[model samples]
Target: MKLKDSAIRPTAIAVQSPASTSTGTTAGTADRAADRTRSGVLLAALGVASFSLTFPATAWALEGLGPWSLVSCRMALGGLIAGICLLALRVRAPARRHWPALCAVAGGTCVGFPLLTTLALQTSTTSHAAVVVGLLPLTTAAYSSVRNRTRHSRTFWGAAVVGAAVVIAFAVQQSGGSPTGSDLYLFAALLVCAAGYAEGGQLAREMPGWQVIGWALVLCLPVAAVGAALALPAEPVHLTGHTIAGLLWLSAGSQFVGMWVWYRGMGAIGVARASQLQLAQPLLTLVWSVLLLGEHLTPAAPVAAVAVLVCIGVTQRARG
Candidate 1:
């Protein structure tokens, strides 16, 4: 997806006071920082794993449902689950003024990205799709830099260019083997998904990340429900045990727990840093696809993967 650079409209990070420093030895401060970093990495890894499963699950569900039906069902189920959890926790409703932003974020991130990606993966290999998605963080960083008009060193732009090249090369290699209309659609979906993610991260700072997502789902449910009802007639295949299991996993792991963890990490670490963790998502998805789906490994896969890793490292260093 082509990343859009929306103007930065002041996130919570901008107004946050600096962390308080207690009188401690230099080594103690270092140790504490290290601990926090490790914890963040652990949480981020969990979030990545949860997200990685989504593609395969969607693939499985596609066997039984149309893309819109699958998406609407997932959203409906996920929103219900999240609502129940939030209500149990007594989460307060956001002020009315926040509704528009919440709706925008929800539409872009929750509805548009997943719906399009599900449609794309209908004919695309999870491996190819995952590689294409590896550029998300760089796209997001580019969006942030552009929005803030933040000056970035030439090296940062160079790394982003290189990362994009690697992804394109990977795509070309996959395309040569078997390029289908669905594959092209999936590629387009990747761009859209990246844009939605970048926008969602930016908006998340203004509203509580979880609340932004949670409420967006709330506002979106009625519309999604209506869409699902209309699309139900086109859902030809009957749901199987495997499909049911996939739906369960998608709802519990990817939508509910994964989103919660991601929002928590974003709240603690700020969007840019939290987004860096997403660099691991595509790689992790590739691993899951191979192990679970019995997909053959392509020779170019590892090379492209390493290139993406290098790019992510460079991007992170640049941000620092």
Candidate 2:
């Protein structure tokens, strides 16, 4: 008796070798995926470390510089560095289609978030700013979900809510039991910063990460330069070593290099998982705040940190 074609097909499929070419290709693809994931996590961690100093450094520099002056100078300097890099590398201008996305990048990091954070730091301690900025990763994740039209599990949303509560509690405890105007500014900064992160990460999928930031900086050059010029003090900058050091770090590390790596990581591992790595940033920022800005951490700070960390971990494990 002869078997039908469907019966024969089933036997043939069932007898397929594990070491077949197709299976080998699948295994190789998975290995590459794993490698990309590991590389992206490391890059994200480095980016986070570079950014950890920002709030502390900005607060320290605000002692000598006006908020507008600090924001303008940082943007101008960052733009110059990015321009020089683009020229030296001979990177072509991004396609005109990318201009809108570049505008989003410039608006968020170069203009909105930096300006708002500088103003906020003029009135807030680095420790308080760190707690407020801790809310950023969740914001980024939320934006990512909306942009991708993906749904995360209820557990993930729950974890985010818990994390937000911890941040609010920490902010209140640090602010002597009430929210302040500075917290409001930092909240605004988070909103803009998250938007930028998501948009830049999306752009990075199609272009080089460095090119994305470099172009964004170049696009904002005129505005940044003009703002810095107008905001310049009539008196010569009597630069203190600490203030100058802070400004340079903000210009070189946080504005340019950190963003380059961050976008690349987001492109590689995706915005959602990459943003999870940022949960470590606020903790690191507090360390920098204590050592650099002489801000003392409150008793509740550690509790908040632990709670946020647990929430982040839970969110990562939850289905999306």
Candidate 3:
């Protein structure tokens, strides 16, 4: 009986200990937040990995189809994919207030970026193009700041600038120290795509991430369909295995799946942090260029990759 009473007393004491209870609760909350951040980082990383394949795939696609045809068809196919999902789920139209942003997303992501990048690839090597597009994260972060009134720590901006400088130097060196015509297209792509990404990230916070992209796809379906119809008849088709595979990936993996997870990650973490993850994308794309396109890896690629990774770590540690 004494032993039982002692055990009960200890239990009562433990249950009444405010400090212990508070500590446990705080630890649990911190653990959950850390887990959520890790998950968000993982999702953003996956999207970047998916995107890294895009340039090589686009190069492969160009082998058998004209630029206009390839872009239009991929857009059309991506729209169809999202449309089917929306229909199956019976998702209603987005609120009227969201339409403008939806239109921006549709125009920038589905059409403008794809068309410009495809055009650029006609003149640029996959590696060189990857480096130029590496500026996308910086652009996206800036756009998010202005549009959403988000703030970041100086460490974050410093790291982001360092990463951007590395990529910019790589881009200039790869371009023989002058902006080529293709570089202009890529830069233009950055502006529109940054807008799309910032807006999509905002929309993701209000709705399901996949649904944000899905609705944008649906909104652009008519334009994509018409463009595809016109372009297919104009462009010659060779139907190589590479072209077919590339088109499928661009349409399904990048246009839909990548953006789906990307927006979700942005919603989880933030536009700024998630965008920083893309600093690794050019490095990944460089690898893909060698493996898939049989392109030579530049001497600067390894050095740039390492520098960018350090910057990524710093940005990740920075508080908003």
Q: Model 1 — TM-score against the truth?
A: 0.80
Instruction: Give the candidate order by descending lDDT.
Output: 3, 2, 1
lDDT by residue (1-320, candidate 3, tens digit) is 34665565644333458988899999999999898899889988988999999999999999999999999889889989999999999998899999998888888888899999999999999999999999999999999999878788999999999999999999898888988889889999999999999999888889988998899988878887888899989989999999999999999999899999998898888889999999999999999999999998878888998999999999999999
In candidate 1, position 101 carries an lDDT of 58
Cα deviation at 146, candidate 1, in Å, is: 2.8
Q: Runs in model 1 with CA error above 4 Å?
A: 1-41, 177-180, 203-208
- What is the model-wide C-alpha lDDT for candidate 2? 0.84
Q: Which lDDT values do the candidates have, in the order given?
A: 0.69, 0.84, 0.92
- Candidate 3: how large is its RMSD? 3.7
Candidate 1 lDDT tens digits, 157-264:
777778777766776677685556766665565555555555555555566556656776777788778988888887775798767877777767787677666655
**Residue 97 in model 2: lDDT:** 93
Candidate 2 Cα RMSD (Å): 6.1
Best by TM-score: 3
